[model samples]
Target: MEPLAARTIPDLVRAGAVHFRDREAIVDGAVRLTYAQLGEEVNRFAAALAARGVGKGDRVALWAPNSWRWIVAALGIVTAGGVLVPLNTRFKGAEAGYILRRGGARLLLVEDGFLGNRYVESLTAAAETHESGTSDLPDIVTFDQWEEFVGGGAASGGAAGPDVTVTPDDLSDLFFTSGTTGQPKGAMLTHRQSTELYVTWSALAGLVEGDRYLLVNPCFNTFGYKAGVIACLLRGATVVPQAVFDVRETLEVVQRERITVLPGPPTLYTSMLDHPDRTRFDLSSLRVAVTGATTVPVVMIERLRDELKLRTVLTAYGLTESCGTATMCRPDDDPHTVATTCGTALPGVEVRVDGHTGEVLVRGYNVMRGYFEDPRATADAIDADGWLHTGDVGVLDERGYLRITDRLKDMFIVGGFNAYPAEIEQVLARHPAVAEVAVVGTPDERLGEVARAFVVTRGPADPGELTAYCKERLANYKVPREFVFVPELPRNASGKVLKTTLRSR
Candidate 1:
């Protein structure tokens, strides 16, 4: 009930079509939409990207997935003042042709054969196998000419919505990410740093107004486009997308969309609580979820509240240079404080931790206004006191709650102390046959580096009983001198764990 002084998201879709007009904003399967027909299909795709010339600050891109026409072409590319890059529907056309040529994207609007992969024949065979620098290639707009490109953008005689202004310091969305110099940079984000910090991340993840949500994370990540379609268009909820992530078609769309806000990634609620036809759906209208990890499994946060009766199961932390959120976890915390911490630090953000190397830094308006044009990797990631160091590793506690613990290039000194493989994969994800764990560091001429665990088991596990259950709860140089077990956990289509292909096996 509070989103309309809108600092642009096309003025929060024209003040959410006159304050949530007939609510139900987007359903996607049989395609429903409301909020005045999602503000007239995002003002007719921002009047067909201003009749295809697409001006104001340019840069378009958007390769599709999670539909409702990728939320009306990403709210019609920031409502035609354009910026919105997006891509990564698992990239690979030379990684979406180097972020549509390093974000100079003057238009792409793809979707050509989505999961069947024909994005303009894989960016024209990766620019004819020269694999990138697709010589300034933009202007494509496929997906069967999107309804004849929004039926020839009804030029002005169609009640204008493309005269476009978009302020709150413009540039609304660029994204990219992947950088330990493996390339892909673009971050940008404004329109008042994404409509004023996702309305303070949807009022610290409470996200009210007729809820419903369920967008299985992946609108080119930022947890599915800024906490899944701009926090479900600032709270008049109902989004529903789910293009992929099929735990039997997500328990039949949260038992036929009675879904009540289910954010993802604690292995998407441990693959819907180890789905064996999870008691035949009807997840009891789930009721808010959130999840984050480096370790969340206090018996899967007490079985997502005693077997999927989830009533706000949060845990959080962030990265994507902080716009993917920074910290969270307070829906009356406890489940071992939402499974070993990450909460706190979102209100005007500022986290800190480096008491000589615990890394986690941050500092607010949700960080990124850097990276996009690289500037020497944005001064090696926001320094000179504007903090944002974040090379991962964390600690914080004293009620300041953070936790994180690994990735100062995945720490690992051993025998000289400092070991963090997410602190032994958060203590081998509390064994009971560890279902998915990672930990790395393997090169040991007698402990110059040791911890090796890889594990994925959900049933029969024994590396000497998981190295005597991490030598009875870790600290013998944080156990695991080698565990291995596999069957899944290579991950990198933004699902993370590749711990450099498990330290090259």
Candidate 2:
């Protein structure tokens, strides 16, 4: 796939309308549109935003799920020369307010009543308890009035694109951290950074023109917005949005829409395979899958190929700070390689494990400009030499395959040996009875710290049996000292296992 001629997000819309005018651009429930129609809708929304004083560099917060409207709203924000600030749907009322206040969002577009939750009301209720009160909240726009708002703005601007010039270097989106450990700091990305990266991502992931990609990932996430929606636009592929990831619902959509491209974490595949009614769904359309996490179970990759008949299953590694991508396995990579490692970095980007500590460091165009409005934090993250310290422990083999071991904070010391949970989890996941597992350190009298395996079993599994399993395969010092069975592992909306929560337990 050639690099997009248009550098900016807004210009991508313009180019798409002309090049893929007849290709299906979006599919959301009853709504379907061609690239031309999508371009028109984006133009209308941009005009409205521009009319409402959303000038260049103004921050506009968007709180919504995966949908056609969210795509248009996001594109419109950038097209109007506004910096997009996306709020996670899983965020609490207070969390939403914090991002809005911190990002200095002048306007907030929310989905209102989704899954019986009123976001605006929640934000309002949360704000009343805040020290700043409601005075700091941005103007709220609900999903119900979407048509009216767009029509009014289009009427004023008269169907022309917003009167603004967006350059490649202009800020495109402001992505904030999950704030699990502290207040979230925004990562600023320019148009060129996001556009250039995902264009390469789309190509490497085997995304092609006319492929129907079911985006189960949230639009608020880097993978969903850039790799899902924007990648589709960049590749002439169709965007099929799923608001929330439900295994059965995912199957239904795949069967109904003939979805060809499915990208998600490994948990998505596991849930689908375990569903009782999975085999009933016609999933022959699934061909390409892109998944990544702390680790990928080799068995799951085989099952996806054998049971689901997906041909191209790839693994990748990245962080939010890297614009959601750094390295990705190629389409032709073997299942074991795909399961065990994230491929080499993209061309022009550099990746190396720290010589003494094995922490992954990335320096490239895709690295975020810095943490928004926090010079100290930004300087701490990106060194003067331009290398961004990822804080992730990984191994870069001679072949350049990057194997993520664990987060530096998540590594455990058992006796005098180092234990990476991802490595242990990979071994445990091979057990027929084990569906998923997380290993964390717990204080031990003899060893100072020992690994405790939290297992979600598919079949009957005993702690004694698991201990012997680890003992036979792993070094004595690396074997988990305890095992706990649970119905499911706790995870954030983005499907990362909550190791912090597990350690607390």
Candidate 3:
């Protein structure tokens, strides 16, 4: 096996500038930056951050869509020895504000407009209420002023502050988990854990130099940031960042850019296969594909090889706590294994399912340090034995391949986004008409599973009224698709609501 190259994100940038100089590192819309140019911009941005009193371990929140500037800002924050707080693009004002205040972010880099929403205004208004009403909240910076933000250092000869001496254990990022119960908790990950995990991931995916990678995944998620951007940087691959995923537009990009790598959930491929004009675009350049978040149909794997002409197709499984890597299907694996299992554990990771209960337990360097500011919750997740009790149930085959059977928690995926019934129920409980609520995942043809809410009402309430109330509090994806009112919820003798019964209904 090839030895891992760099130790930190900043070191990776320096290495890329030396080896891949003059090569196109990023292509976002009309902006094309060479490795050298990217390095220069990162250095200047780091300097600008240093001038603003940002230092090691300071949190910098980034609220923006997928763009070259997002990439630059993330790298710049790491280069300056600051922790990156990535806000989900789908997050509404209150959701984003809660994270910012909890993480205590000092600076917020945001996009003024995206998908017809102005984030700066929405975030500012939300912050006014949730943010302790002090000057400690992050100072917002818009994308339009991005050039000037970096130019401040360029004007000063681009000299960043004295070396901060970051070690492997230094915190790299503070990623918040999708909380199912109440408020979300930040998962603390170190520099070495993230870099090492991605190195293993890149090797497993067979990423190579000169690969034209197309990123349709959101940059906030691990799929896009760690496996997408960081992996591309490791291999000297050209990054083609697409802000949104559209079948026709993706087909155009595949032909125009001669993209060799495409990785997304099953829905992404399904959309392409179902497109009416998929035949018109030349998708011959596509060679590698990595898909898994929701379920992967065996037919989709077959179609990828036979119909789409893709040479490599892989499926894997992971969670945010595991640095988005635990197991992956190998290149030589058969279609049956690829489709049915999440493949064997990675080189250094350990995955074992309980013999009786089938709960999956993981222990490895890839596991996060712990949840920030919530030691009790962290203890609940990772026990004293060093094993992370992933609330997922699975079974290991005779050959060591792992297949997930069920979730011990009531968490479900809504179009690849993890939705927790506890969180939704907590929000819905605020409505005057809702006396009690229980949420469960129901089957959906397109999105894999959608949330169906069961409610016990105190007064007259309609589905439309309940949905409108939820829309005001949660992200669109977390909103329930159907609402069924009942006189009371079925509960076990111990007073636990029977979610299984709710799901069955």
The model with the greatest lDDT is: 3
lDDT of model 3, residue 394: 92
Q: Rank the candidates by TM-score, best first.
A: 3, 2, 1
Model 2 per-residue lDDT tens digits across residues 4-36: 767899889889988999989999999999999
TM-score of 3: 0.96
Stretches of candidate 2 exceeding 4 Å from the true structure: 1-3, 131-135, 178-181, 410-505
Give the per-residue lDDT of model 1 (tens digit) for 109-188.
88888667677876777777656766457779886788888878887423456776778887788887654434568888
Candidates in order have lDDT scores of: 0.78, 0.84, 0.85
Q: How does residue 217 of candidate 3 score in lDDT?
A: 84
Error of 3 at 240 (Å): 1.0
TM-score of each: 0.31, 0.81, 0.96
Ranking by lDDT: 3, 2, 1
Better of 1 and 2 by TM-score: 2
Which pairs clash (backbone N, Cα, C closer than 3 Å) in model 2? none
